[model samples]
Target: MTVTLQLEQLSIMPGQRIVLRDVSWQQFEAILTELGDHRASRLAYDNGMLEIRMPLPEHERSKVLLSDFVKNLLEALDIDFEPFGSSTFKRIDMAKGIEPDECFYIQNHAAMIGKRRLDLTIDPPPDLAIEVDLTSKTQLEVYRVLGVPELWRYESGRLRIDVLQSGRYVESPISPTFPDLLLVERFPGFVEMAATAGTRPALKAFRQWVKEQLQL
Candidate 1:
């Protein structure tokens, strides 16, 4: 039997997160759609376990900056991609559900081009997903089940890229989207600049930096 929190009866504290065990996929979907377009909290479900969290202000800051960094890099490198910010992805048979902070289709962009709707069973999963984890760790295992190809995790002003290999994710020193952009050697400083310079100036600086790097 599936059960959910009786919000009308329960008292939840400010910034309190709620998790439910034995939640069916349908219940999770209903809850996700009910809370449509709300960015105050993030939710994830794996099999029958569901987790909800209210992100901190710093979380949003890092998320925006990190997403800006990727979009800027893609534009500078002229890569084709589609952004799916916080879209819910679930597969009943796979017993997995996720709402990524931000996701994108790059290498498989053409495959998904002009599609009216995305069905993970018939469609490919997003190539990359970004998580600015300030409150808790991401469920990479859930992503692994969903067949996500790559992940970028930022925590405490640092960034790390992980690429799916076989059935496991292996941390990589180079970005899967831009292989030439050395993640360990060159990307860390850029992350710092974004977090410190504020969004607009950091984006401007990043555009300039990418142009310079391309010229070299």
Candidate 2:
């Protein structure tokens, strides 16, 4: 059976993918707390090998806002990625799959071809999957399950970069996700740069920084 992911009684997307909706906040809290307290890690339910990612509360806002930031950046770079897909599916998927506030494909637009469920034929998990964490769940379990090569989790205004290696994830100071973007010496300030400069300005600044390093 398929489920739709929705917000406030409106369908956000359509597909056979599982989605979480219609559950009361109390019930949602109960489930999240149990998973976090007992598992001490992130958990996603799947009867088959299909991947899933779920987000915690408060993170929803964080991820959405970050999406706006990233979307603007991608546009400035002339990169192409659809902001959203299959709204009707999101409105009703009961399986409770997590949605990345923003998602994009690096290569061809043809990769989006599929029905009901997401087409995973592409490699490296769509270049990046950004998350906003408000709980104890680690990216280790989440990224592994998602089979994504790179993941960026934002927490408390800081970004933690994770790179998938040998079927597991590793935390590193540098990000393998956007190898072109360098964060030398001032890695921590990357988000601040994005925040303060705005998307286009921040991206231009990032490019300038990269050029400076190349010249040096």
Candidate 3:
């Protein structure tokens, strides 16, 4: 349940990624707490593999843009959702742990409605996870182990909607929650537009666009 490697720093794209080898579950928990209130570093642990990477300013920028867009879209559609941004999710039985860049409980919103702490043993996983992948590639295996149903991955200035099927993620042409929207052809460009527009303007523009689409 661990990768035994030295805490070596490898120079990558934006920030430093420190990889630790042979870490115990207790140590991981301690480190997470030690990291208390630090928002810029991201942590990933699967089995015994532990990776911590400091996030760049631009990374946070793109993440917020995409996050706001999804939240705004949900509101416009009048869909009840609970946003969980960068919340740690771990299952001891599965030996996997991860925190999505942003996640939402939609289809199962009612199940988790008004709740705070999420224990996978009792609470269902988020129906959709939003991942901003420009900084690094997300570990799909983590999501698979957690049994998330859908993923929205944004990378290299593009957006993709994926749905999990039979223990694997496949590129989906449209979103399950927002089924009427055609993602492959129209949504990617729209994503860029909204991200560029900033949150307030983006919400205004998105609500207008959604109304036009629904003819409301």
Candidate 4:
């Protein structure tokens, strides 16, 4: 059985160190088994420390903005990646859980067919995971446990990336996962503009940027 206790006193601080406690990997797996697709997050205990995870709330604009940017970039470059569904990440099972803002798939969209529950063990990990952090927390640590290849965290309107290297996460400015793509410095600020531009304007801008990047 899993139990959760909230430590509201620990107000999340920006760039502050987060400590996870009282978690076990086995316990986390059990919780995942129970919740199935309904599960949002899970906790893992490694050595002595605990890790908690929950799903970040749904932000339609952010998802569309980011997804569209990636989709258009890939299409313009003739790279193949079709996004089928996006899910908000959540961690359950341990003493603490964190839910990232959004998660998505690049390939293997066929595996997701007719499925309501996500079996991480069966479902291949996403090609990319995106998190928009309004507050600081240990959400990224889930990537370590899940072995996701690439992670993108957006904060303060800037994007920071983490890619798995030699079985561990390393932050980098360049995206090894999609090396041909170029995201301009002003790209982060594009999200705010997306809100005002509506779908057509945003798509136009994204298409323009993609074409420019591809010299098409």
Q: After superposition, which runs of candidate 1 have C-alpha atoms over 4 Å from their true positions?
A: 1-4, 8-16, 114-116, 134-138
User: lDDT scores for all predictions?
Assistant: 0.77, 0.48, 0.76, 0.57
Model 2 ranges off by over 4 Å: 1-43, 46-58, 84-97, 113-125, 134-142, 183-216
For all predicted structures, in order, the TM-scores are 0.87, 0.51, 0.86, 0.62
Order of all candidates by lDDT, from best down to worst?
1, 3, 4, 2
Best by lDDT: 1
Better TM-score candidate (3, 4): 3
Model 1: per-residue Cα lDDT over 1-216, one tens digit each: 846456345444435677778878888878777777655667778878888777667776767767778888888888998888777777888878777778888999888777666688988889999987634433677888889999888875567788999988899988867887665565567767666776677678778878887888
The better candidate by TM-score, 2 or 4, is 4
What lDDT tens digits, residue by residue, belong to model 4 across residues 118-190? 5565666667776655343345565666667888877667877888888888987777756655453646756
- Highest-scoring model, TM-score: 1
Residue 1 C-alpha lDDT in model 4 = 94
Which candidate model has the greater lDDT, 2 or 4? 4
In the range 1-216, model 3's lDDT, one tens digit per residue, is 944533333444455676666678888887778777546777778778887777677677778777777787888789998888888888888766777778999999889877877789889888988877734443577887788999888877777887888988888888888888665565556666655765667667767777887874
